[model samples]
Target: MNTDMTRNDFRTVAREALLAAVQGLVLAIVVLPCGLAFVVLTLVSLAFVPLGIGLLTTPAVLTGVRALADTRRKLAAQWCGIHVPAVYQPLPRGGSPWTRTFVLLRDPQVRRDLLWLPVDMTAGFVTALLPALVVFYPLQGIMLAAGLWRAYVPATGESTWYLFVPVSGQGTAFLAAVLGVAILAVGWRRTPRLLAAHFRLTRAVLGGDAELAERVRVLTETRRDAVDTSAAELRRIERDLHDGAQARLV
Candidate 1:
């Protein structure tokens, strides 16, 4: 029974890790082009800001940027159980294009979203792709081990390195397979964690815990101030003294 349960646990974890890895592959592919488009549009629109064309276009582009970030937030929450809040300031309605443009520019969240685009394309792209790579890359080495190296050696006419093992013959190919199994052993433990890291990175930039922390800080300070004010009022009441406003009224 214990052996059966252990096998079941392994199967469950492997299934979850495979699903997450594939999901991350999809995310990585989608974010790359979207991030590039947004980055180019933002730069082009901002360049035209002085000419007034950017006044309208900039805000629209920024709205798209926010939408992209929000979509990632949704994906993070829905797919990875990571809750990232949207904390953008509301833009004034019925305003001129210039007013809207400046309003977006003034928003810190807009800057954060802009910052996240490049990062999503670069660091985020890597993180999102890593889980799939970790989980699947070893399979290629195993294929090489299983005589696939012959097809490659004739085609390439040279020795190919399979994860630092040179695969020119059966013995070397077998060595590649051993390395592959070693990598698979490591990946089995890390695939789901790697997938979660991608979403965690998204949340870090897209207002996850920082926004909550700031809100908590503000609430704490407000509560402290209220307590101090109440204590001061009680002290005055005990001493039968009136504050400035009360004394003036009396």
Candidate 2:
């Protein structure tokens, strides 16, 4: 029974590690293009400023930026199990385009999202690449151990080491394979944690800090509303009693 439990645990860890590696690769592929588009949109928004076209178009650009940011937030939440909730200020209604644009620009959450663009691109890039790289490096080592390194890089006569010790000759390939196995052993334990750490950083930076405050504000308003409703109900009851029952008693 213990052995069966151990095997199940091992399988679970392996599955999670594989999923994290795939998630990292997907993130790497998607984030780069999204980042580039975000940067381009920002520049275009700026250029439109001089021509006064931004008054008409900047909101759309900003909307795209928000959409991109939202994608990152959603991915982090879904893949990494780190929920980064959004808390955007309500925009004023019935405003001109320019007025709405300025309002969006002035919002704290919008500003934070704008700043998150470059940071997400850079940090998310590293975050997304590291898991895949960590996994790939070990596979490369195994391939080197199989003597395929000779075909890949023909005549580089350098020694490879797991730490500080030298690995040389055909037997050295076996040592490389051993090192690769060791890396896989350790990586299965560490990869998920490392990936979670990266997502935690993302959540902290991109997520709302004012959640508690917002909750408090909402609660306060709700409490007041409830009190007002109760008082209104009591007044209606009193009126009914006075007009019906009290008149009958008199």
The candidate maximizing TM-score is 1
Off by over 4 Å in 1: 208-250
Task: Give TM per candidate.
Answer: 0.82, 0.77
lDDT of 2 by residue, 1-250 (tens): 9999999998998788888887787877888888778788877886887688888788888888888878878877777778887777676788888888888888777887888778768887888777776776688678777776565443677765644435556777677778877888777677777677767767777775757646876898899999999999999999998899878988
Q: Which residue segments of model 2 deviate by more than 4 Å?
A: 155-172, 212-250
For model 1, residues 103-171, the per-residue Cα lDDT tens digits are: 899877788899999999999999999988888888988898788999877655678888788788888
Identify the candidate with maximal lDDT.
1
Residue 58 miss distance in model 2 (angstroms): 1.6
